[model samples]
Target: MGHTLSSLYPVHRRAPVYRPKAFVVDDLATLHADIRSGGLATLVSVTGSGLVATHLPLLLRESDGPFGTLLGHISLANTQWKETDSGIEALAIFTGPETYVTPNWYAAKQETGRVVPTWNYAAIHAWGRPVFFQDADRLRDLVTQLTDKFEAGFPAPWRVADAPENYIESQLKAIVGFEMRITRIEGKRKFNQNRSAEDRQGVIRGLRELGAQGDTRKTEVADLMENIESEPPAGY
Candidate 1:
């Protein structure tokens, strides 16, 4: 293999290992959109013992603030919410499509053997103070909204009202509702934006092949990369 004229200079610099903004997504709509699509989130907070985390599905209220509010309910038996302090901060992490890319997927690898394997992923972090409440009426409303949102895609969507009123009320009594008024948020969408067009195309092709082998991760990432590539160049 021989070097080309384009190889005389560095075409792309490696991104920082920590919080590189090459694909940092700051659009408020996009951030909330990802959260909606990926309903499950890991909520983390500092407890008296140390740090504790609970995984739950969160509903986003966009009009609540500049960031937004995360709503969810947990079992009353689970004292994690009770241990949460109003003065302390908490974090909620939501993740979307992610896949591993091999160095062989980059054209630059064949040219200079300089490329290395890396992971591409999309994620969002929401930080706030946890507010817990047990009002029966509010809990019913929150549970109904959560059920409606999740069931909307089903052909025969189920509703909270579908169950017996007494049963639904009893269920709500066993749980506690909480909301996190987001004070800060960070969204990252690292999908080879730092790579050259040639390398990116190579990644897209390789991902497609893996997708054909029945890998959902590969399919999702490939679709996202193709969408970015198909978009008009910035500042048209």
Candidate 2:
């Protein structure tokens, strides 16, 4: 056996997220909030063939673990569930609003022409070992939970019982449910947090102007940036 530098000084693994000090979100509660607000998640898994990913909405159960449990279902026709390697951890990426930030929005641009365009956004990445199931009863419960969540704002919410029993049971037989046991979680909110107040104000103005012109995406970014002003981030 050969002993190399690794033997003398072991190296720890770096976090999967490319988060800067100013962008990392550390609060568990905040992370959960962001995940729920994001609505849909991109679930990724390492399989024997390679990597596979699926886009779906997941229900976040905070009482499950320190981080939380993610409930979602996939069609049996989709091979991802069968291919997933239990030994490997999975990732659920929840992305919030994102948009381009023109250098014109930076106050420094006018002074030194030193600013360049960039992107501003928020996202949460959760790591966990996914547990897949095919029980019809559990699948029915999962469907009902997801249904009630999305329909809550309506005057009258539709539910699983609204469908015919035979049809509902047949539908359940076509899908498999899964729950992710969250082992580690991370979140990032990058909305001009590293910029100066003047620069940030300029961004807010530009974004709001765009929003007034019918680009609601810009408005979302602007709203988050404005929030930073009201509640200053505890920067690293």
Candidate 3:
């Protein structure tokens, strides 16, 4: 069968989430790693008006609560924070590496002719009530921490202090910080773990071979597939 243009592309990014029992990632350490490396996340809240979503980066505090806490800020002009319902739980989604997978990689495709294409990805979801604040001191502290964490990746890392104090103070007034103490957290890594070892190996090899040609994202997916042996949580 010939692949159509649509089939050549990946499964939709907005595909409804349906995690199989085998896909549930129930480990704190692994969940936290995905949260950290996922970098930017989408914060969604339901309010009197409707649903609002903000895309931003958040700081994870593993020691803050049973699950954890998320720290981040938004522009003063962005009304999503103000419109969020405090009584309702907010959702923050962190997305890691993802790529389109083809059935051609499956050993079953050739042997049994019974395989379908799927997308492999890693993601983390955190839920909690968001508490927004505008205290200058607290905002300063939050921004400082966020700056340090992200800037550490650069050779010449910049710090909050590098900016003029007055400028920083003025800027702080133009934004508000929020804390969402995670009441629940879940991570999912769908990497064909349900497939037979032969099929899984073929997938890894196919992904890596694609990576060798230039698409490093495929390699990232392959790397996770290679480590599907990590112990799953209880009852799963």
Candidate 4:
């Protein structure tokens, strides 16, 4: 089941001048906190046959160890999981809001035509070995935890046990649960960090004009940058 693994694609050359560093989150507690807040992640795997990907709502759990495991369920009918070999490694991509940056947003556009359009986004990639769990109790626990996490804020939070036991049991059988013991984690917050102050301001203004999801995301990026700068130096 072991196969030669290829290195992940490097950050785009045109990306910011910042040196890309991989952040290994050895504390599963911290990792799970992020996963819980993020809600959804994209699962990707490589098989001898080809590549497969799926968007999933993940349930992260921590243990007293270097890395924690991720819990999720996929449709039983999905052949992708079945095709994966025993030792196959997979990647889970967690993405935050993203925005589009127009070329006109760069102040450089006024002096020269050197500027090009780019995207601003935040994401985390988790690489690990996946193990599928087909047990009924395990599946039920996963589902219950997932529901409780999402429904906690609601006045009438829905519970799996609220439904008939037979129905819940039957539904659980229709899907397969999976766990991934993460080995590597890469987090990138690709905002307009590399841009000049004027250029960054222009980009923010442009985003305000667009007023779409991208624009809102750009505003968030601006806020994050401001927060980072405003924070006092360590041990201050």
Whole-model Cα lDDT of every candidate shown, in order: 0.84, 0.86, 0.84, 0.71
Q: 225 in model 1: Cα distance from truth in Å?
A: 1.4
- Looking at model 3, the pairs that clash are none
Worst 10 residues of 2 by lDDT: 5-14
- In candidate 4, residue 166 scores what lDDT? 92
Cα lDDT tens digits for candidate 2, 120-225: 9888889887899999999999999999999988999998899999999999999999999899998888887788889999999999999999999999888887
For each candidate in turn, the TM-score is 0.88, 0.92, 0.88, 0.77
Query: What lDDT does model 1 reach?
Result: 0.84
TM-score top scorer: 2
Give the range where candidate 1 is weakest over 10 consecutive residues by summed lDDT. 8-17
Tens digits of per-residue lDDT for model 4 on 100-218? 77888889899787898888766667777688878998999899999998999999999998999999989998999998877766556555666677787787667666656555665
lDDT: which is higher, 1 or 4?
Answer: 1
Give the per-residue lDDT digits (tens) of candidate 1, residues 55-112.
9999999999889899999899987887764556678999999999999999999999
TM-score of 1: 0.88
The candidate maximizing lDDT is 2
Please state the error at residue 161 of candidate 4 in Å: 2.0
